[model samples]
Target chain A: MNPLRPIGAAFLRFLEATGRLSEFTAVAVSHCVRPPFYFRLLLRQMIEIGYYSLPVVGLTTLFTGMVLALQSYTGFSRFSAQGALPYVVVLSMTRELAPVLAGLMVAGRIGAAMAAEIGTMRVTEQIDALATLSTNPHKYLIAPRLIAGLTMLPLLVLVGDVIGVFGGYVISIYKLGFNPGIYLKSTWQHLEFMDVFSGVVKAAVFGFIVALMGCYNGYHSRGGAQGVGAATTNAVVSASIMILISNYIITELFFAK
Target chain B: MSAPSNPVPKIRIRNLCKRFGSNVVLDGVDLDIATGESVVVIGGSGSGKSVLLKCILGLLEPDDGIIEVDGLSAIGLGAGEREAVNRKFGMLFQSAALFDSLKVWENVAFGLIQGGRMDRIQAREIAFAKLADVGLKAEVGELWPAELSGGMKKRVGLARAIATTPEIVFFDEPTTGLDPIMSDVINDLIAKCVRELGATALSITHDMASARKISDRIAMLYKGRIVWNGPTAEIDRSGNDYVDQFIHGRAEGPIRMEVRAP
Candidate 1:
């Protein structure tokens, strides 16, 4: 009884936490659709979530694209299939690396930021002050972030797609001795609209998940400074993992055949 | 002075009960405040004074109670109803709780712009006027909350509380982190603000000086109930041992604080 007691309690706690997260997500999303929208707050968050996140997301996907071109050349050279390099770089960048890498990078940046900001507010009782001011915290704090995440990620993914493909072009033409015109031609010829579309869709979903986890962890944070630190770490880690998991699920949905 | 034949009080609580896990915070407490009156609830840390204020503000729900505000039931209100009730209230939290993201004037103007749906230009004008009332200059309103000193933050918080001229105002530890001089300044501001606006005021403080200065009547909360309540002039001679020990700040008394770990 003693040996199993701890495990049973741990499992129960996990279930309870999961239930709370689900309920929190539901309330946050519901508030996002309701009236009394704070458009100024929404615009502020768009600048915070999308524009400010560009440099990090751009750099990550660009480097990943460049590295993919170089590595694919090295591996395919052995099989005498080095002609597939451009196709591989374009397809992978649009379908996988652009959205997933961008998601993870933004999760690391925005997730930690949202958690720290909201967590500090929680500890300082600013959230309670909002309640007293006749404002709903869900509508004021969570909804704008959710809307920004939903609307901005697709744009971010599109920008990532361009930068990533350009990166692959730069490496292939300048470093790999491939002709610039042919490389660009092959990349464009092989790329379909669905490839970019799917990644953008994934970006939107990843954005929602990232912002939701950030807000949820921060809103529920208590204690003080240490609690805010834990919430920040939890926001980044959980958002990154959820991005990976959802990427696979989304990819399977798009191209399971 | 509260007679059975009198009209309804501005605020009333009957048999309020709130428990947190196994630790009971409030237990069957009843109290009343008349219109335009100042009432202060005094208690030490963990005595649930904050919890009582949160319950009244609709930030926390009491397990069971009847809370009447302005002669209307304020318990278990729906979201729209709760917001409606909350329109009449303003709170100054322990740390001032100013929104760090906003400029001082924006923080003060938040209730007017967000809740009242007033135009931003008009709200900013009101916010600056309120800031001036709290002895802050118009330039001070442009700075963010982080730039302000502790005392300045409390003043800004006070300005925000009275920005809309709310009918009811709550001061939660209004002088918690200030020096003696600053604490006295805040108490004076609170008294002046409540009086000038003719607002009903309720405050919770462990600072005896704050209680004595701001409140017309004082109540001491012990073990989640009102142990003593009377006019501020009578606090020193209230004769209740708990009140006696608290007012005098003596370590020995009927209140044996649980100094050890739970």
Candidate 2:
């Protein structure tokens, strides 16, 4: 009986924390519409959270596409179905790998950074300062981030999709001895607009989740340095989990027969 | 001071209560701040001083209370109303919380340009003027917050707080982490600014020197309630043991440290 007590306490804590998060999100959304937009601050956040994250997302997608081609080639060649390599690579990149990998990467990079920056601000009473100055922190801080996340994620995914397809193209033509034209044609034929659209949409949602979790944890962080570090970790973990869960739900919506 | 006969307190709290789960931070706290008076709330760390300030600012909702500013109830106000109320106040944070992304002048002019909807040129002019009021040069307005020293940043924060020329100002731990000389400088600047603007000021600090220097009235917060409140000159004769021990920074007093066996 005593052994289960700690588990029950943890569950209750989880419920409390979840309720707090919901309240925070509600406040953030309300603040989004108010006036006093800080366009300059928003542009800076976009550059940092979106543009600077391109290299890592790009590199990850490229390698992922290349590996998919190599593995699919090996498996299909056993059945004399090596010709399906182009379709497999393009489908995987456009449908799942591109968005998921890009999301995970940005979740680690931008999510942690947002949490640290905001958490530090919280500990130092900067958020309070904003309120006292009559500036809504949600409008000034979270809205710009939410807008940037929504806009930048799709852009990042589009870039990743392009790089991923190029990765497959290079591997197939040079290493696998496939006709470049035929491989390209097969990829174009097999991929649908829905697939690309769904992936990009998922990127937007993932970006929102990442930014939301980072901001929520940061704004509510307590204590000091330890609290900030904990918030950063929580942002990454929560963003990653939400991305995976949302990906499944979106897939179910789009692909359920 | 002659009574203005307009019975509205500058800031009023009646039966204000705040609780974080089972921990009560403010318990049935009632206070009145008159117009153009500088009141300092002195308390030990973790004594709910910040919580009281936050409640007044509407940053934290009091579980049970009525907080009124200039005769308007701030609690449960709609977004527009709350914003209108906030526009009448300014704040200087403990660490001079300037926005790192903005130039110094932009930070000061943030409320003017955004909330007041003034044009950029006009806002910048007023910002430069306010910066000058805080003893900062016009060129210093071009620098980022990260590029400024602690004292300089505090001055910029002061400039930002007064940029809109609000009727009330709140200073949270104004001298918590400053050198004595810098602390004195900030104290003097605060006195000068409040006098010049004729603004009502509410400040929270553990620094006795700061309290003595800048306060017209001093209120001691202990255990989520004000134990002693009177004119600054009466602090020495507060005749309360808690006040006596806290003012002298004595360890062996009625205030017990929550130190557990290690």
Candidate 3:
């Protein structure tokens, strides 16, 4: 009857569940190497997870870029450093803001949806149906989503970089009375391919983590409706946390020098 | 072990035991299903009937057992080997479990196109034909799973299960959530499909009417073990108290429900 007993039990259960997940992942990797690869399903998931996610990422990046430009200009102008506006804007957008914002946006959108969809399938026994029909659900479901995440995230990051830079350009030239040519020149001169590449690479890794967490939580979900909801919540929260953690690690790796 | 000489049994399980934690679901269970035979396993809710089927299908691993299909050991098969074993199976899920994102025909044609690597046009043609076989119109094939009625969804599920004309077919609780008339219709369709395909079938259901209608042999699962098994015609005279208590839906019996104080 102790109150701490339930909390202790829950903690133990969580550890046990994590252990199971590690085992499932090992099995999934092994299955992936064996053939009868479902290329069509992978292509279909790529379209759903990647192509469909472009618009949302693009919109978020554009608005974010514009706002960052405005905010940086406001902050820098107070110190009479308005000349450094373009350098700061492009550097910030490409190196940190674009990938992080894009990762978070996708975590909310694609991560939640993937979890819910896979969770519903688990409850409905569609995943079981796949197994009974000689189809490996991991191969058919997880592999495609993973491939899509790895492939599409880089593209989404590229799009985000462009939109974010363009947003800064608009705010600088129209709102802040800067010369468009000079602004563009300063932005290009300050930004390096390595910065863009690193951000894109982070986006890809973040995307993979998001989809993996979503699919993993949902695929192993039990009970029913409430379980599906829990899976979705866990997927979004976990993916967001992983994104933040990985972002820091990648930053150190890329900019340590 | 000596392999059967002439016709191979489609599925065979020996000394199967499954325990979830300390709670046992299947205990020393053994079953054999011959080619072209229809076997129905019947039991009360929580009777481990589904667990037995899942073990045979290799979806759940048994704690200690051997499961063979077409003389191939299914228990420890690798992924490629498991896929080969699974290619011989078609299953109708209890909830239909249709993919909402796909059109009806696409769902039906999923295995044929995706697993079998058949062309889309050919798969669609086969899917439409299978739909027609289940008395569903061609137009139903174009609609999504969400758009279909419960009965229609079950029919579409039936079509998808049989899309590849698998050698063995499993029906899990085929009549659980349907009107009596609709259940009868599904049973009839099941019977017809089994006959036409000459496929071995293993179905689990609590519906005695369905068991009687579709099965040549009936097995009754009780307390993690099959207590009674024989030809379907002998079910009425089995004279087993557990079977009687179950078939009549009586509250007073050896089988007791676990009631806990809240």
Candidate 4:
């Protein structure tokens, strides 16, 4: 009946879960680097994670860029600092918004799919079948996903950066009655290479997190239909949370004095 | 009970014990299968039959037991040894557990291409041949698992299991969900497949008809222990109350179903 008992039990459960996840992550990473690589599976995953996600990432970033320009102009006009609008829009899109937004979108899309597919496999004994077939589930199912996610997200974010900046340019020139050439010049002038570089690095880490969480949740799912449903929800939710948390840590590493 | 006298059984289990918390699912179970011999373990739901099979298959580790395949201990085997042991096995799941992402032919050819490192072309040919052995056409192999019917899925599962020509094959409730006729057909296919390959067969099922049809020897598991073991021909006269009750499908017997109010 002790009140402290519940807290101790909860802490123990947390420790147990953390230990399981750490072990799974170690095994997944080891399989990623090992040989007898599945080139065909990796290619398919790259197309799934990267090529198919173009429209979502593109549309999300494009609108985000346009809104940032308008919001910044309104805030800066009172101080007669409206000229800083281009710098603000370009930096925000590259440094934070595009990567984080695109990451959240892809996590909802790819991460949920990975969980549902792998979760179904686990419940149906297909994962155990892989082991019987002399194929490691980590190698056949997870490593390809991790590899594709790590490699493809940066590229998606880079493309997003361009489209997002262009959205801001469109708003500034036509809607806000600013000179197109000057806006572009201003955006380019104040931008540092580190801004884009840090975002790309964050995108890569987010991609890995999304894939890892999806695979981890799905691989461990038990029971049946309900278990898979829970796994899918966990995959998307956990991936999104991890993306936001990691984004800040990477930002601090790059931007903090 | 002691295992039957065999010079070197293909698979041997002694003092096998497994439990989930306070619920003991296997208690000091012992059994043996000789080379090219077919054995079926019969038990009702919750009788630990599947757990016994899984322990032998290395899917679940028994808390205490000795499992030997070809005189090599299967428990606690290193990765290389485990993979080698598993390479000799093919299992037909109760659900036919095909990879929905792959076409039927790819599922059949998976072990050959992935495990044997054979080229796809060669593997596909062998896959088609295995499918033919299970009375399936080449065209059927092109379809995905979801497109197939329940019976077709079982046939494809059998084809996949035998495609690699494994030395040992395990069937986990192979005909559980099929119609009576379909079950007989699957049982026939199983017997034919096992005979053609001269493989050691171990099947677990609640269906007495299936056990009688596919097994040379039958073992009855009750409450996590073997209550009876005898040749298939002698099962009808097993003389044990549990065996008689199960084979007859009687509601009133020594075995009672646990149906407690939630």
Candidate 5:
């Protein structure tokens, strides 16, 4: 009944969970690098995580860029700095908004699906069946998804970057009465390669985080339907939080003086 | 020489123990199955029956035990060796546990294509043959597991279990939710498949009818220990109170159900 005992017990539980997650991640990564890779499974997961996610990532970033342009215009006009509109739109879309927003959106869609599917498999004993059938669940189930996330998120974000900047361009030229050629020129002038590179790097890390959380939570899920539901919720929440946290760390590493 | 004085058992388990925190599940379980023998461990729900099967299957490690398959120790084997050992094993889960993402044929062919590395076309043919063996039509193999009836799913699961032609097959509560006629059908099919393959068979169930039908021998698990072991023909006369209570489905017995008033 000691108050300090409860805190110590909770701390121990946290440390145990962190250790288990780290081991799971290490094993998953090791399997990814090992032989007998399931190319078909990898292709299927890529299509699921990347290609299927295009429309949502596209629409989200496009609208984000549009709203960002309007907000930047309102703020810049106060100081008579409206010429910075294109620069702001392009830089923000490439460096931060596109990757983060696409990440969060994809985390909601793909992360939840992976967790629910794997968790259901766990609860149903299909994962144990996989083991009995001489297939390693980590290799057969987890590694492909992990590989897909690492590769596909950056690609999705890159597409998002272009679409988002285009959204801004459309808004500035049509709504703000700016010349199209001038706006395009200003966007190109302000965008450094490092800006896009850093974002793509962040996107890759975010993708890995999303997939890792999904697989880790799902793989360890026990009990039944409610356990799977909990796993799915945890997957999305953890992935979203990790994305935001890693985004800042990566941004700081790239941009900090 | 005809044979060694003591031929090694296909599967030999001794002093098996497992505990989840303070709740002990399996407590010193001992069993031996000769090659090509069919043995069923009968127990009520939550009696660590499934845990016993999982431990032998290497899905769950027992805190203390010796599990030997074909005279070789199975505990703590390396991944490659474990996979090699497990390749000879197939299982039919209580729920059938089909991969919902895959078609029925794919589910059946999974062990073949994944474990045996047999090409899909070859595996599909073998899958169809196994499905036919279980009294399923070839057309049934194309449908999703979700589209299947409860009985059909069990049949498909039986088909998957026998598809690899495994040396040992484990069935986990094979007839749990099926109707009587369907249950008997699955039971007969299980017996037929195990006999045809000449495989050692192990199953865990509370279904006395299923135990009698498919098992050559029956072992009754009570309080995580094998309370009785004998031929299925002798189960009715075992003279064990637990067996008597279990077989008769009686409420009054030495074994109490822990039911509390709400």
Candidate 6:
């Protein structure tokens, strides 16, 4: 095998995929703006993407906050810096952990579900049926999911932020023998509006990325059951990686001084 | 089955071609369906009958061709124009393609509610009426498609196909998976629905019995082209070796099954 040839082919495939993705995204985003909103479908997707995911996201963020406080306390106490634990916990939860962790979790749950569901629909010719019925699949299927993802994730992350901070508070006050009043006061004092706002903004973008990847991979999936399996894997894996990549990018946008 | 003098075909396909990479599905195929006519394209699996059906419905873009439906050119239609052309069509997929998420009635009423701009109550009533015409009960309409039997699913699909009384209907291998008795039942219902609506019908099937039952005319596709086309009554005597081989299900004729290399 020629080294350059494989690299060239892989590069060409990447470019081709990027072009297809751009086209799909353009059409889907355009459909999101148009009329015939299909409000009922949007509502259903909201429940699926947001409401049903509350418990899981809540648990993930809560546990993460607890772990963060524990780790920070252990690290800070060695340098007589235990006073900074609450500040660090709250800042991390609001600015980075809440959005990133929650985004990764939703990417796993919603992204995989969307891919598997739509991939099965593709294999079954339901997408073709939708087209034949004078319905644009982008409008009917992908647009609703995108809207739900965009709107609901910020809501999820907001809840995640609150739960995570509360988790840190619980661990700091009860488990670490810190005063509850001091922990609460310290957590609130340094958690700025910008920190939370940037995370929420990141949530919106991450949500869009998850749904977009799910819809894109599922929409383009072919072959059959194995193909659907591949799409599901690709959706979750890609959404998670994109969330990580974009988290850093958005953080730089927000906090790079 | 001869065309009436000066008849304008409701659906006209000329020099239609579609390809996937190196594999050609439809290659310069030509056919016409007269108004209110039932034409079944018969071919083995992978012979591209489904691709031909998809091209006519505007579901698959042909690499090249002219498809005129009801005197409107179908090729290269903008999204709006494509939707306009698609509104004239109703398709029944092999698995009935029922929206398992929707109730039986919602599946039946989809086109009316979505395409015809009809309200739910009105659409449901029409849906029920169509369901009844296809021998389904109102109670059955309340149930989800998953709750229905295979035969019931096909009936619901037929109800959906005629829900809006489309100008043309497509059945994609309508009886492929059903048992013999159920297949016959579906074939009968499809014929009745197409006849009652006076809609032009283009169906793809490999099942000869179903084809003969539902179609007035049969077109045989082989190697991405229409090999022979004539009335169903004359299919047995078409005298073309390929048609004779296909219709008789004999392996000893001119058609050779391509066994892929190991």
How do the residues B1-262 of candidate 2 rate in per-residue lDDT, one tens digit apiece?
2222457889988888888999988988888888988899999998899999988888888899889998879998766677788898998988888987689999999889878889999999999999999899999999999999889999999999899998998898888778999999999989988888888899999999999988888898888888888898998988999999999999999887678979
DockQ of each: 0.81, 0.59, 0.72, 0.78, 0.90, 0.77
Give the per-residue lDDT of model 4 (tens digit) for B70-107.
Answer: 88899987656777899999999999999999999999
The segments of candidate 1 whose C-alpha lies over 4 angstroms from its true place after superposition are B1-6
Model 3: DockQ score: 0.72
In model 5, what are the clashing residue pairs, if there are any?
Answer: none
In candidate 4, the residue pairs with backbone N, CA or C atoms under 3 Å apart (3 or more residues apart, or in different chains) clash, namely: none
Candidate 1 local lDDT, A67-130, one digit each (tens): 9999999999999998899999989988999999888988988989999999999999999888
DockQ for candidate 1, please give it. 0.81
Superposed Cα deviation of residue B179, candidate 5 (Å): 1.1
Query: Which pairs clash in the backbone of model 3?
Result: none
Model 6 fnat?
0.75
Name the Cα RMSD for model 3.
Answer: 3.2
Identify the runs in model 5 with alpha carbons over 4 angstroms from their true place.
B1-6
| Worst 10-residue lDDT window, candidate 3 chain A | A27-36
Report lDDT (CA) for all predictions. 0.92, 0.89, 0.87, 0.93, 0.93, 0.90
TM-score of each: 0.96, 0.92, 0.92, 0.98, 0.98, 0.97
Q: Any runs in candidate 4 off by more than 4 Å, and if so which?
A: B1-6
Please provide, for model 5 over A117-203, each residue's C-alpha lDDT reduced to its tens digit, 9 standing for 90 to 100.
Answer: 999999999999899999999999999999999999999999999999999988998999999999999999988999999999999
Candidate 2: segments with Cα more than 4 A from true spot: A1-4, A30-38, B1-6, B238-262
lDDT of 6 by residue, B188-221 (tens): 8888888777788999999999999998899999
Residues A118-216 of candidate 2 have per-residue lDDT tens digits of 999999888877777666778888988887887798889999999998998898999999999999999999989998999999999988898898888
Q: Candidate 3 lDDT, tens digit per residue, A1-257?
A: 99999999999999998898788667666655667676777788778767888898889989988998899988998999998988887888788888898889888998899999999999998888888766779888887787788788888888888898999899899999999889888888888999898998898899888888889989988889999999999999999999999999999999998
> What's the lDDT for residue B193 in model 6?
82
Q: For residue B23, what is the lDDT in candidate 1?
A: 87
